[model samples]
Target: EAAVTQSPRNKVAVTGGKVTLSCNQTNNHNNMYWYRQDTGHGLRLIHYSYGAGSTEKGDIPDGYKASRPSQENFSLILELATPSQTSVYFCASGETWGVYAEQFFGPGTRLTVL
Candidate 1:
């Protein structure tokens, strides 16, 4: 099974400042994704990677940067965080990008930008 972990589970950032959220997976899944969901909204994809060194823009890529330096590490960066960007961020890993690929989600990073 996939075991994903995220760091600094909770964060508070200032407007126009920087914030970084990190994620690591143990199961060696080939696909990794970053998502943000507001209190009453669905999962909004921020970024995704098919493998190391390859990153793709998802549904909501603006104001976010993503890095996949290794097979096990993926990071989400907010260069200039805004209050509107604050939300629960999630990291997920999957073996494939098909319909049947069950994504394993890590604990969310709750960000509060003031």
Candidate 2:
């Protein structure tokens, strides 16, 4: 089975509060990522992992932390969130970064920070 899933599909956070979004992939892919979608910026990467216990900062890593406890699990944490962080977040699992690599995405998570 191939699937990517995200928890707390919808979230409302208060400014300066803590927020954590979780993701799981059953695809057993070697790559996982966290991204935020905004109107003008399109989709911006926040954090990613190559595999268990391996995390890398993405295009926009500020204000975010990522954890990869195992091959199937990845999480994004915002210790002090802000309204500017409000956006639709997505988690994806992929085999690699190339034309032949296939990626599966979790149903988007809507996060609104007030």
Candidate 3:
């Protein structure tokens, strides 16, 4: 089964602080993604990687950066956390590009920037 896990399920940070959210997958999939979920807006991708050592910016990558150092691990970094960055973040993994590629998501990490 494809499984994704995230650490620090909930976080409270002060503005301008740095925050790092980690994600790991056990499915050995080739694609991993980081997204933020906000009320009324569907999941917006922040960054994604096709495999290790390849991080690509997604639709909303302005205030975020991502890293994929190995097949099983991906991380999202918030250089200067802000109140607007407060949202639920989710990590997902999927197989290679295909018509049927479906992403399996982690529980989520709720971040609150004060």
lDDT of 1 by residue, 1-114 (tens): 559999989999999999999999997889999999886788989999999999999998999999999999999999999999989999999977577489999999999999
In model 2, which range of ten residues has the least summed lDDT?
95-104
lDDT of each residue in 20-102, candidate 3, tens digit only:
99999998898999999999999999999999999999999998999999999999999999999999999999987677499
Q: TM-score for model 3?
A: 0.96
The 0-to-1 C-alpha lDDT of every candidate, in the order given, reads 0.94, 0.94, 0.95
Off by over 4 Å in 2: 97-100
lDDT of 2 by residue, 7-114 (tens): 999999999999999999998898999999999888899999999999999999999999999999999999999999999999999977677487789998999999
The predicted structure with the larger lDDT, 2 or 3, is 3
> How would the candidate models be sorted by lDDT, starting from the highest?
3, 1, 2
The residue pairs in collision within model 1 are none
State each model's C-alpha RMSD to the native: 1.4, 1.3, 1.1
Off by over 4 Å in 3: none
Clashes of each: 0, 0, 0
